[model samples]
Target: MENSINVSSEVGTLKRLLIHSPDSGLGKVVPSKAQDWLFEDIVHLDTMRRHEYDYYVKTLLYFLDTEKIKGKLNEIDGDESRNFYKPDHPDYFNSEKVIELQKLLADILEDNLTKMKLIAAICAIEHEWYTTHDELLSLSPNELAKTLISGTTPGNEMLFPPIPNFIFTRDIGITINNHLLLNKPAKLARTREALLSQYIFYNHPMFAEIRKNLIEIPDNETLFLLPEEEAESNQSTLEGGDVMMVAKNHLLIGISERTSIYAAKQVIKVLFEKKVLDKITLIKIPKKRDYMHIDTVFTQVKRNMWVILGTLAKPHSESEDEVLIRSGLLKSKKSEKVHLVQFRRGQENEPRVIESLEELLTEISVYDLNCSPLEVQFIYSGNNEFPFGAREQWTDSCNLLAIKEGVVIGYDRNDKTLEAFKEAGFEAVKVADLLQDFEAGRRSPETIQNTFILLPSAELSRARGGSHCMSMPIFRENFE
Candidate 1:
């Protein structure tokens, strides 16, 4: 059997994680195209590639596989080898298959040397990206990986913008309680992430046996299409950043600027049908770039403790609640306004409406969490102030990556938020300090507890993502 995923809690000990190295994609962005790709400012490709992302990759390699698959290009390069193997042979493929593979390589690859090297590397991974049966078996694995990371397309003369956000792999898809939810990205800039992630989960040999258990959302476009139709503005669109697993049987999905309420309903419907989720909590935040996804403003860092934005941590007033009710944003038993039509198999049932968002969540937790009551102590970003809190949040003060029950990582520039964590009993330790301790043989990561290991923020923070935004945990032990 292949390695399986089992993430049940945010703070569980992380065993396996998925990450993407920064590539030529970052260089593809120019000043005029920066904002369109969700970049706040243009970045120097050399600085981004050489400095900012190196430590992040080093940190992840400490916990996950870091080896590169070497290929056999020299032996397989000649036209004779390409034309030799047939379907009946163990190696799989014949002359026609080799021709198609050669054509594909020529269309996407710029030089003969790079094309041969990539083909060799792909041969090592033993997977194929094909248009047909013979074609699939003919191409090598290195070619597929190169195509995914380099943003090259077959038959397209014009180069597309490399997906720089691909470095932030956390936004693509999420594994919830052993089931992989292949998400549909809300932006064209991030569509490649979804496709590549699904390909890895479904076709990679590492997940070959466990692929049967994955539940990929079927509506997303997998292949790039030029002059594509505009996505229905009102239709459902989901992103992994908006989904959170709060408990073993409980999930919290944000219906915010990036994720639509329709998207939340679609995910909720699938969860209910699978019987894996007992209750689903939907949080509605302001629709804006600053609060694009829930993880940007909210994440659980430890048991009974969450990092949240100051404005959202506060409860609503009676008058404010009443206004929401009247506006049809908040429903009640007296006014059961229907907005979502629930579907089972191919049949549709009566519309599902909530009495009140807060009420629904509170009532559900009362049973699922038992007497502990699922009370989460929130540590808000900055103090209770206007622009100060907003400024800190914009820099990702609330985006924290939880390594284990008590260890977490975030940007060091968020001083105010770091102080808040210190006040809440989490000791603040700089990455330099932690690295020094390990180097001197005084301590290792396992020996640290209830500590916030701060990472340098000069370049990474400028990209508008913290540690949590960059990593996607694949296997976390159950905390309970």
Candidate 2:
């Protein structure tokens, strides 16, 4: 049951897609301290999950013979009741709940440590669960360094950190011409999602099947980005939330709140090693408190085209600490690394740098592409002051869901963003009222490309990731 989206085509039908239906995992959040819990607002987890299921999962399930939870591990690895170990995991055996969870997994999996890695896998799933009052109080210097990466202990006064808002299979990993460059999240809060994605991609039968293409390639043929490059992070530094898959061969990397220019560079290097993308176009999303991903700006509209929220149409300006480029690398948005790269290794590759959203679109031939076969478009975001207009742009209005070909679903908050679609002669459907932005994160394309997991849990709503940001489509309908 492997799924794929055909690239190099004009506009492919979304023949099959992956979706994560929300679940009880969200009930873990404490609403009163929503923001502290990585949530912008509050919603009933049970009802919210149900709502997303209807909007994303059930709506498209019949359209696809979606792959359910991978039963391969259940039969072999036993994630629920299996007991695994990670001697170097740093946090294993730290919490009572984790210990209990381990036992539960062991009972369910019934495998020896050598055979099972369930404990580590579950810890990887529970990103915030590792941060506890006890764990925080007793941080050694090493753990302290890791905690500092997360900035500071949140003021939520809760037992566990919030799970990832969503790990839509589509967002975290995808087929880079067959081999999947599964992203290892730069942010610890979202690390669990990466772990889950890793599990789904590697342990699951379908993704595992496709992996052969990756390993079978020639050794010097190209390795994609090395995993070591992805290891660099500032802790609370960034998440996959900000990344955007634009052209079939390019990645639109946004250096904003959660994602840094340096981190993006590192990620790109990994992709290059794997031959994932031909190049990565770095886009500077406004570093506001609200908008976390580039997805808050745009997504696929029709075949060979995109529907972008207008705010990102502007260009980049020098930040306070910015410095002049020195040839090898240029000034980064926030981190110490250079934003424009001459020879950086990872996420930073080819910098088709631009200052404004309009410039970026022009460089990508977005206007011309839209007119021809692609039909790419752009619309303004927010009322008057978009990120380009306003000092702050977060509601994630830019993230959109491409329904049928050029047809799309998106947030209503920034109605202006829809102008691009209209201008391009594409139909845009407003889903604000009926399709709530269940998670504070508004990025669409969250669902898995061709599965039926439903939004992993209440976390998607809590983390503010929309369907787009949550998913990473391995396969898509070819639209040549």
Candidate 3:
């Protein structure tokens, strides 16, 4: 299958995306190493796979490649081995549309030279014994691919720490229109992920045609020469979660916990030079782990609508007295505020200062999308309730993936956020129920509109990401 790469807008009809399922590596996340691996808490691997991620795979397949999963649902579920969900197995539902990262890794490993180079690279970074390279080389492509990701050998011995965060594929790379911008992860735990992704995107046949368009952010030339404190501040680290290709001519880059200001500046300079887009918006959120990426605070539900955390969405009050108090409070706690700046191609010196996230999103709808002001809408996280708003936002209430315009998938545990969606005139349905309707021909993915599909997320939510973070959409029907 030819891999068509294009994603101009967040709410475009998703045609193809990259995803990684929960591997044995997740089960190996002991409490002591959980934080180091970037997981808030350890999760039950079986439950996360069978109950949580499996549903995501099925749903994506149903929407993007219906013939791959439409009638075989029961048969696929009945198998005790669950080979249907295993990328290495013969029965794996290998749909080109709903692409698997592990499967792509294995495909690249099939080449002898690529396998040797990758194994050597891994061993060098991991400080593995020289013999370890030969051992990994001896394994078959499928087994080697599994071991590389899970950090385990065929004998069930751990060779190294697993890349557990690989499940959040969106952090690896992002598709910007016809170009691919790869990530330089901020955390040491994600170094292996970046290396593995570099090899895949550069070496894989699927990305061969678009290799020239791969955008890699280079570090500052004098970064190593700076003082320790200055070097730390100047480090160029970026993740896909911080970048959003919101429209054909517009892009959003967030400076947060995982994406540095230096990196954002580099992106703006490189993209502007390449003429990838006309405008770039820099959203500076607090450098706190709770709001790791901009998508965690908000995401587009449709061309004219957005779901956001109320605290950052807008000012709390319009009354002069309350505004005065808020201004005083903000002066002392400036770090907590969200800052927005917009830069256009020719007018770089006169960048526009956006007041709030709501204002920026409204402008994207009204000006970029050409939607009427009256048609634009906002759904606050936790329905804008006090404690619920903060609590649900932490669980990624605002982080959602739109399968198509006005149709999204989020964690089922976010009840208040679901309520917010309902209040915004969207039908909230559980994934299991929706799958039945799709199977029975009662509803179709194409026919669905103004709906929110909920996924079972008891274990999945512990990983600290929503469907948006789990998906790396490479192809979407362009609104242009």
Candidate 4:
């Protein structure tokens, strides 16, 4: 059956989301090879995976050492075919007895490769049967849960590189107004991320039917599948972080460091062709790591409010209206204008000009957003302080995740941004504080609006992402 997906606005109540809690994949990263695997720093995975394993082991012990097992052992002892079995017989050495033991272990072990090894050991000792890897994966969810969260290796070699960047799930794919656009990350570090989303949407039972009506877009790698001449200079790539829905039918995508114009053009073509979007506005920002995605600099906090990097909110051009009129290139009813400019990069040999949105208007306004109904007000990061804005932007001050209209989640460390929100009629609160109040029945989420729920960021901040970058909402309740 096809599952219905309705995500029309960023602040809609999230009903379903996909998250990969940290797993054994962390062990695949090492200091010497971190960069190769896309990790900037090494995490203590052995402890983390061991904790998961230990929990699984407890579940195994509880399930295996049951009254049924005792009864079965007694039955084996009572049976007297040609040879009699004894209660004291070596249970580990007996094939029938060991089969139950192996099943118990396999059911709770979380790492697939390690589970396979357990299967191999059982077969080798029993000399009874050999199980294939596919057969192991086909086990029940009770069995697969133990194995899917971690990675496994044989001896000293790393079989699967840990997906550290998986925490920032927003970069893997984008959920358009109604369709899902799976992104092809520009770097190899994130290819598996794309594959994971693809697998879930295609194979996972929850999304099986949705595939029928939902339009599927390509990863940048799809370009390589085309002829060389067709693929040349077509290094298109899009990350979910760069794509956003500012209104019911209006969208804004950034052609920034992480997203390329080539990729944007391809995505825009698909959106228009499918009629999935009415007005799509593409913005071009300076290609810098700190501002890798547009969300890093701009995102809707509510229907009429937005939080923006101070640099972008401030007019770089002489006049915001003039820039829009000169650079704005609006299409007919179905299309909008984007500006593109040509410039030189660091070296004369490098071309560094941005292609305009109507193809490069450097302003954020009603015309720029292409949504006149939106009377957007700004909440500047660092409260418009130069040094503070620069610092907080690096730490993702502008990237906030809206849970409901006027209520959002962000990093607690960005105090200035929080103050800016408060100044603009938003109430400030911490996640921990909110949880305590909710548990006490003191308040409900529905009653909260324009509230900023700040998350602790000791380690999360190190990932260089904010709350918006950490989640990929698959479904949201329709508000209209």
Candidate 5:
């Protein structure tokens, strides 16, 4: 099968994606190191997998590759070892459409040269394990792949810290119209992820044809000569969460906590030079952990609809006293402000400034999507209600993944958000129920429209990511 890559829009019919299931590494997250691994709290790995993420896999299979999962649901569920989900196992459902990151890693490691290089590279970073290089090389490709990701041997001996955040595969790389832009993670904990991703995209046979199109943001060479504080400000760091290929000719890059302005600048320059995109919008959001990435604050539900955090949605009218205070701007909080700037390919100097998030999204809908102003819609987090808005946003109510236009997957715990969806004339259904309906021929992925498929999120929410952050759509059916 050819590994064709093209993602023009977020809400396009998702045909292929990269996902990593919750592995033993997730179970290894200790309370003290939970935050270090980018998790809000340690989750019950079994519950997160069987109850939450397993449904995600099944849903994707049903939509993208029905033959792999349609009639075999019973046999898959009956397996106590869950070998079907394990990439290394013979019984694994290795669907090309619903690809697994670990499976790809294992595939690449099958070559002795690649395996040796990866093991050496990883051992070099994890200095303590440098002596075990020979031991790792002796292991099979599958074992080595698992050991590299989970940082444990077959006997469960810890060689290094597990990459618990690996479950969020969207951060590894992003596909933008036949091109793959690799990520440069901001956190030290995600260093291994970046390295592993680099190797996978560059060496994996599946991505061989598009290797030339793989864009890696170059670092600002002069930063080293500057003072520590100055260098920090100009550092080039970008994660996949900050980048979105919203339209065929337009891309959105967020300057947030995980993505740097310098990196965004690099992207604009490279992309324009290569003519990958004609317009690039740089959205600078508050550099707070609460909104780590722009996707965490908002995501497209359809060509004409979006779900955004209410606080950042629309600008409020100011009183005469407030207007006067704004002249001095002494009391205004910088952290709460959002700034948007759009740069066209030729007119880079005279970039257009957007006033608010709503205006920018509205423009995309109206201009790019060819939607009328009256047709556009905005659904606020927690139905825009106070306390609930902030509470639900914290749990990623805005971060939803659209399997198709108007059909999104979100957390079931966000009741207020579901109510908002219902108010907007969307049917809300649980994933478990949806799967059963699919099996019974009562409903199908194609038949579902204007719906919210809610996943069990008791443990998944603790990871601070929704279905959007968990998925990296490599291919989507063109909206046009």
Candidate 6:
């Protein structure tokens, strides 16, 4: 709904965040349709919801209220309305249209009949039963989402496969330093993701002071693909999950499935014009099932070290692959061209020039390129299968969250990938409670509303994805 290209630095600290709670949608992901709905298996909606929510509550409790982290946020003002940046808040998150109508309905017919009639109309899309004689569903989404233990159908549409994954928070968008880049979701079903994000940028009182609130920023006619509103074309397309902030100036974009190069070019054009970026290197990875987005394969944990799910940085097959190499530190620390070195794999572990992070940075002239071992490294799910390639399929290594300096969060499945972080001087912590694993197909969520990751399945089979695919971080804690 709102496209504001606000990204500049990678070390910028995260001040406020928007999150959506897993809602009634979790109840709809039936085991029968889990495959088409993108789930491995159905989960016990209630228990799964609890596991997922606690993960966020625990993390936030450690940050938002803590004096150390609170003081670090650049913004000092704490306005409840600013919490538009927080989607879990019902005032900004629930369908405003529905709420508005409900209020009007209540004013006219403030009886049980009115309440029941109103709820039935709102949930006509889904058949919901009225437990209270009062008619109106009294439980907040968080309450229903948290208390739910098991269900055949997901009550909330946004929380299921196509939508439930939004809770991961790492997939939707990211912050390169202090700048925030809003992710453009690819599906209409997830279009509400943009709506949800807009609310977070608008209503959340705590996040009211954020600089990139799309709703409040001066609307730029130049940024809109269809400024006329009536213009139509099959060409307008973009998804936040396909983009990643590789460095302060570098972004690894995937042109596949949801987003295309045309959209990538448009976004790049906007960022370039805004002086938001100095360089843009598009890495067109294979558009296979395993390669959904950049998050599926690679992520930068420390300053120099990176965790790659696929062999994009390595060799793929018997043929020799060539990659473009650039210098990020050359000319100057603020060199216009980002240094990107392509690793060529010749058959098997063939020796290549500039091997290792040390050589990679030195050759690029990043003399002071410094990043201590990260506190933790997470993958999409808990899949520990290494260079086995399935790591690219099952475990999404691309979904990474740099919450603070050297502190990151991600799926807990990449057991060995965690080793990759430690090898780079990080203390990798594995966490697996963020997603709803299903029994049919393997899909991960890159978006997280507030702290909820939406997925269709209440169970784990092979259909649904984990946190990396459900979230997109518009801001982050400093990395370097």
Q: All models: lDDT? A: 0.61, 0.43, 0.91, 0.57, 0.89, 0.41
- Model 1: residues with Cα > 4 Å off, grouped in runs: 63-144, 152-158, 218-233, 318-376
Ranking by lDDT: 3, 5, 1, 4, 2, 6
Least accurate 10 contiguous residues by lDDT in model 6: 96-105
Most accurate candidate by lDDT = 3
Residue by residue across 218-320, what tens digits does model 5's lDDT show?
9989988999888876889999889888999999999999999999999999999999989999999988888999999999999999999987876644563
TM-score of 3: 0.96
Model 3 residue 425 distance off true place after TM-score fit, in angstroms: 1.2
lDDT of 1 by residue, 20-100 (tens): 555556666778988888888767755554444544544443333222101222233233433222122244322220111
Output the worst ten-in-a-row residue range by lDDT, candidate 5: 315-324
Cα lDDT tens digits, model 3, 32-137, are 9999999999999999999889999999999999999998887877775764677887888888899999999999999999999999999999999989998999
Better structure of 1 and 5 per lDDT: 5
- All predictions: root-mean-square deviation over Cα? 11.2, 12.5, 2.2, 14.3, 2.5, 13.9
Number of the candidate with higher lDDT, 1 or 4: 1
lDDT of 1: 0.61
* TM-score, model 6 to reference: 0.56
Clashing pairs in 5: none
Better of 5 and 6 by lDDT: 5
